[model samples]
Target chain A: MSKLYESQKLALWYFSVALVLFGAQLLFGLLAAYQYLNPDFLYGVLDFSINRMLHINAMIVWLIMGFMGGVYWFLPIETGREVVGIKLAKLAFFVLVAAVAVVVLVYLLVQTGKGDFFTLWFITEGREYIEAPRWADWGIVAVMLVFYFNVVATVIKSKKLTGILGVLIIDLLALAGLYLAGMYFTPNISVDQFWWWWVVHLWVEATWEVLVGVLMAWALMTVLGTPRKIVEAWLYLEVFLVFGTGILGLGHHYFWIGTPEYWLGIGGFFSALEPIPLVAMVVHAIYDAGSHKLRAANKPALFWIMAQAFGNFVGAGMWGFMHTLPQINLYSHGTQITPAHGHLAFFGAYVTANLVLMYIAIQRVRAPEGPALDSRAWKLAYVGFVITIFGMVGALTVAGFAQIFVERAVGGATWSAYIAGQEHPWVREPMYWRFGFGVLFLLSYLILIYDMLTIGKRAATATEVKPA
Target chain B: MIQGVEVLYLIGAGLVFIAGAGLYALLYAYGKIKGSILLQRSSYLFALAMLGGVAYIVAHPAFDTFWKSLLTVCGLTYLFIPKSMLWVMERVHLREEEERKKEKHNPFYTNY
Candidate 1:
């Protein structure tokens, strides 16, 4: 067995926590889908709003956890030194996990709007994904500060300043900066919406894009022995592309939110451009793999990387572009189209990025030579990936299109009318499809977690069984 | 109600579009070029120029429909140029590799 680094053990613990949260996220996702089919499925026990909040909150928290874990694992390797403040890193993990636990407990138990400030602190700010209470937000920010300090200190101490490290550090700092935008509360809806996009759009489309690029570049170089020059060049291009286009892409959300008419053109045009980087990434990976005859070691990692590329293109890129236009978004704004894009985009972009990181960490610790193609875990994971991807894309696309057609295209324009239209058979039927697919998605994650846990043990047993 | 300077801006947008297309062509020919350092450098410069143009446009007077259209076209062109470049370069590289493989296997071929 390969000797694991101490920092890597911290990463594994983070991954284990993230995996559990991922499973919890899927459970809440299924519950939300179930509510769509049968609104009374868990009416009082777990309301739709609560379920949806849990789902989104769990996803955002877990993905951040995954990113933090990945940073800890890769930073030491890139720096050629032990992680600075190892104790602080572990503390950050525990603090974050504890914060999540408190938030989840509060979300499940406490009811909001009791006219009490204490409830507000414990319950939430009541915004969509930023629903975590003020206290939870403070906890998250605190943990993030510790993580940021550790990463920055490590980089500053290192002699070499690689392009990947530069991008990662800048991106992490920006992530911390942008997250503060969500903490401020205001009565002005337009101002609130503007800053919210600073957190949401910037984090998802801009900062996270840079993070993914650098991390993916590093992984490709480390695993495939791809030339650093080429990967670094692509990283630079990605930074240019993301910041140049993605910042203006925020104009898209500004469209119907009482913002200026000019945002319509800016948002539509710039957001349309957002997909170009994703497409470039997919092409970059394909070309790099073809040009280099590197060993296909760590097949699962490679598969997830490709999935990250293609999935982001389709989910965040294509699906996002679909409704990003002012005309289309005018109709699809609050409809199921939003959630459809949300599900696929988040899954494709962040979820697969985390999975790729996890697979890399797993391959490093468990199977340095590479896991066998026909290993039970690998086979099951492949099936799980396919089922989850198809399940999400198929169900969500059907649901979103059905929503646009029934609620907006045919029905009248008012919000009440849209809500009434959702009751129609056409709209509600596709939701059942989403529910079914959600089950498959949950099952896929269960299989993935099992595979993650047992792959090393099974490999060791196989080696023992073989003749020496 | 297009001013003379706005017309110049429109013309500048057109020029940028053409420049973007030209950059795409250069990127497509990346394999034939000895090194991509120049290509990479040009991409950065192009990105900087685009940022400058965006700043200039945004800082000017209120954006009418025509100006909005101009900016929109410029942004779209800016977005696709690099992507198209990457796509074309990959294809060109693949084609070159295939040709090299064919040349190597030719029975009549001899190393100098």
Candidate 2:
């Protein structure tokens, strides 16, 4: 194992924290998936809503943590200087983790019926994505500010303004700014829905898209030996595509909402363009790989990078565009189709990007001697990735299509009809398939984590690591 | 309520739109074309046409169908305008790069 800079070490700690939260998130996700088949399985001990809230909140928190870690690890390298405010960065990490712990505890211990004023401060807001209480929201903002400040300070102090870092900084600022939209309360449901999506859709589709692009550019340059000039040029194009189409793409959510009617066309057209950048990304990755004789050493990291590209294109790009149109969304809204898109999109774009960063960090700190591709950890992680992707594409997609067919196409679109449709053989059968795949996905995640832990030590002990 | 004819029209329009999009994607994915700006902007026209056609066919003013039609027309128009703008931007960038390269080859050119 090679020694790492202080900031990079701090980033590894953040990665470890993210992994812990990720494991917990998947556990809740499995439970939530089970609830889809048997709502009464968890009953009083854990309501479906509560289970869902935990599952999503954990996913969001861990992904953000992973992003933060990536920024810490990469910023110094990109800027050619050490990260600023090292102590404060550490403090911010602890504060963020503490906030997540408190939020999860409240979700578990406190029920939201007739709560006292104090309990109100601690309880969830019952909103999707932004379910954390006001205090936790504020805490998240503070932590983000600290982290953001540290990143910007390091970049500015280094006087190295690379395009990749510039995009990342812009994305971080946008992420923090958009989060404020979710903090305020609104009595009107339309107004609330409007702001809710500003946070969710903009973060996932716009800012995070840019983040992924910048990170992918960095990884291509580092691992594939792609020229910085070519990567940055593509990054510029991505920035334009993401902001130009992605912001307007938020209109898709407003189609059925009480918003103005014109949003249907505006959303349909613009959001339809959203997949272009992702497709471009896949092309970019392929072009870079084909053009350069990449270092065969970091094949796992390279595999992840390629997966991130392909998966984002298929999941976020194709699958997202599949139901993004107003006509299709009219039928598929709030069905299993939504989760089908969410799982693949999140995993492909953000999750895989983070895993690539994790691999890089692991290699840098622990296995600097050589590649650990032959380690049991890498093989298991690869297997897990395959299983998870198959589960999402095969099982979840089948379930989503079945849901749309039975509930909306056949069941006449009433709430009771939809509930009854859940019991249909077509729907129920695919859901069981989803459950089996979900278990496999969970097992894969565990094996991947074990690989991360043991791969470094095993590589250190052995003189030569074989390629898997 | 959507009639049988309207449903068929909607389905046909959707199929046309999907076919156009699928073909456009294949062009980019297979490296038959490069630089997505032009191809993607062109693809939006198909989507807008489909949305407008659906709005006209359904004619069920529910969910703001009329506004949707208006927006689709506006979007289609906007796509062309941006294509031209991006073309100019690319030209300027390429020109600047050329000038920089020329200067780099001139031995007398040095920072003051």
Candidate 3:
């Protein structure tokens, strides 16, 4: 197939995988949240830590797939050239598919008592092991190289490239850093734990934040009919703020470890500023949308974009700053407050940003000339997402604060103290509400799936655009 | 015994890691709030200075706990907190034309 066809195919492949993964994430999230409420909901079958691992791993992979899809759509626009190598792109796709299957297979095998290659968690069995073999780890890394090569090759061949390519290059370099970091460490949780964050937390939060800023700016500009140059300038400023100051924020994760208290202070201080770019995102988005509100009366795509910008501001920027203080983070780092920052920042900012990319991709590929968000159903999904996100953030924040109070007042300093404190009425109260609100989030996904399928179908047939 | 050196190595490694991470955080915050390339550039330079200081202390292995701890804490706090929180939100505004319209509460509102 031609490169254009291949790009379309790859785009669909990414969206399909992402939706499936998102579905899995919603289910696992519900399960994990359920465990918190009942504590015995699936006690015998699935342990909390194991389920937690799956929840996080699934969320990460799905988001990565979404990012991959977004960049494929973006490369053409940023470079003004179709991606160069069709076969290589397809090869990367197949590898990624196999890699995911390997992960799922490994997860299931780790759950069962068949084999034990790499322990996943310590539930009661012979320790949790990698559901897939170690080669799968290296295999995924190889696939990453393939992806980096494809994008780099395309950009190198293009006569002109935008600073957007700088964003992509940074992601590539970070992945390389993560791979090297991964190999530098061992699988032992005790020692490997901190270094793993070097890849997991830092790479995802810092480098990926840069990528999201650029991609979101690109997508919003396209959908809002804003100028590319204007968007590019905003993107450049955001990227500089993120990397220029964001890399140090990684220290926040290092605090409780054997690392010095100084790290906690520094991490806390610098991360306070981490939200500058996020604040900029929200401010810019609100301004753009509000300015165009009268002109662009149609609000489906723009609504989601605006919502994403606002969500990122609160989720990534404000909430992140709240915990960046050493005094606060000292108490909240491993506790529920971390999750409060996590759910919003990850879901609200990062994932929602990617979703906007999906919306733009569909709009562009289909070339719908009519008013965006014409369908009542799509509007419902957008509102559903907003409501669900708001509910989750509110619930989690209250729960986190309750947890901190209980830990300090009732639980004391030992492991037993912490566990005993879990039984407190205050802690238990918010746990129930958090789980209750989580169900609303699950329902939102059902609406999203339905809306995504029917997006471009009824567009007056006069427009001959293909459905994404 | 090998165990003694192992413990020392671990401690030394921990100090180095924390120092590097902490310095980076300070540099980032300083650069971001100022929106000054010069400030950002100088922050990176200061981070290098912190690294060098930490390396010196590690290599020297002094027992002046009070001084070392004070330096560490001071370095860490400086590394993390931007010299000015007042301008951070405002600098965030300067990045985008759209954001400036919505928020007039810039920390530098009076000066500007």
Candidate 4:
């Protein structure tokens, strides 16, 4: 293995913290899942609302950190230079860590405050995913600014800006800029939600997909050893398709948000097309690996990325399409059906993408010890991924279907119908399945963290595999 | 008196399941994913889920024959779509192969 770059080493810090947050996120997720099965599981100790808020926030933050870590790990290699602002990058990491710690403590210790400016600024933002208070939000912006500076500066110093770098820079800016949409206050609930999707929908569907395209670009370069020209061409095509479809796909979200009815058509048509680029990329990877027999150094990373593509198609593309049509959305809007999409889409797109990146970094950090694909950690994560895709997503789909059937289709879409939806065995039974699968995923997540944190120590005694 | 909305949803949800699981079938046909027991089993679980789904539509007290028939059609759609997708992909691969042969016959046909 080659000598480790300083920039890549910086990735370890980001991944470590990201994993900690990932753990916290899933644990909270398990609690929330259980609360559905047993509403009194934690009672007031860790209420479902607080637990859910923690889960969503942790997921968003950890995924962002994972994205940062992936870029920090891959950029130096892509550019053949150290990160330009190494010292500042380190400081940003710590300060972001401190901010996250304080915010979590606030979320846990002082769950809510008076509904005033002071509360919104310092206590909680009261948003779904972007629940960090205004002060924490600003701090995040500061950290993101540092991240952007380091990233852009490194590319500038490299003097070799490829398509990937160009697209990455623009996407990074959009990713950061869109967060502000959620930070604002407005009197109109309809208007507020209109822009809110700019942050949530745009982040998940548009900017984040572009970011994945950029990261996957590098991953393919590493794994398949594909030519830069060919890779860049695909990246451009992918970017073209992603932004082309995904930008307008926000209409799917607007279908019920008191937006104009035209959104139903626009969102339905475009959002339906969002899966094509991802599935295309995954197929290309398979073809390259199968036809070329290109042995990726870290097969687990490749495997997980492949899983992510399939998961994305299922979660975001298929499930989303099922409900995006205004006709369908009318019945299923607020039901468990939404969570069915949310769970799989978030896990498939961002969570697995992070897992892929984490394994890639782990391989480099533990290079020449043994192939990481052959490790206990990879095995564990793979099991977790399976249980999640099948158990978590599949079970949720059943539950969502049940909710749609009982709560809306049969129940006249009434208030009492919503309550009746909760008691139905079809809906309630799958919550247990979801909770069980969630626990398995958490266990796998813990083992992965243990493997990552201990890989350094274990590398000392690990025997290297000789060439076959 | 069956209208269009819920029927469309039931069918759409079925297709979602079909494609979600059936996608792996396409991958399998393409030889993209092979010999991985985990993925293979994962796909099987995905397929079995369709049965579970069909059962819900079939036996749910709220649903009448209209719903059941619609859902049954979804099961039929699921059964056929994967094979059709694979067959279509096979034609694509066949055409690609034909193009390769024609290029190979030309002396000046250089990949470079």
- Per-prediction DockQ: 0.05, 0.08, 0.03, 0.08
Stretches > 4 Å off in candidate 3: A1-5, A112-133, A186-191, A294-298, A371-373, A460-468, B1-112
For model 2, the docking class works out as: incorrect
Real interface contacts reproduced by model 3, as a fraction: 0.00
What tens-digit string does per-residue lDDT give for candidate 1 at A1-468?
A: 566666778988988898989988889988888888778887888899898889888888888888878888888887878788889888878888888898888888865446356665877777778887888888888888888888888888877678788888888889999999997767899888989889988998899888888878777765555555556767898899889889999999899888888898889778757766765665565455545532356666667776777677667765676566575566667766677678777877888889888877876676554344224666676677667666766666665556666566555456776776677676677777778777877777877887787666665555556622
Order of all candidates by lDDT, from best down to worst? 4, 2, 1, 3
All candidates' TM-scores? 0.81, 0.82, 0.75, 0.82
> What's the lDDT of the predicted structure labeled candidate 1?
0.70
- Model 4 Cα lDDT, one tens digit per residue, A1-468: 447788788888888889889889888998899999889987877789999999988888888899999999888888888999999999999999999999888878886457788888888988777888899989999998999999899998989787889999999999999988888768898898898889999998899988988887777665544555556766787788789879998898898778887787677656545655554544554555554463555666777777776777777766775666455567778877788888888887788788788876666556533443346776676777677656887788787778777877777778899889888898889988888889888878777777666653344345343332
Tell me the lDDT of model 1 at A126: 77
For candidate 2, write residues A241-272 as lDDT tens digits: 88998999999999987999889888987876
Weakest lDDT window of 10 consecutive positions for candidate 1 chain B: B103-112
Q: Where does candidate 4 stray beyond 4 Å?
A: A292-294, A368-373, A453-468, B1-112
Worst 10 residues of 1 chain A by lDDT: A366-375
Shift in Å, residue A316, candidate 4: 1.6
Candidate 1 residue pairs in clash (backbone atoms < 3 Å): none
Best by lDDT: 4
Instruction: Give the per-residue lDDT of model 3 (tens digit) for A403-427.
Output: 5656643454468768755776766
Q: How accurate is candidate 2 locally (lDDT)?
A: 0.71
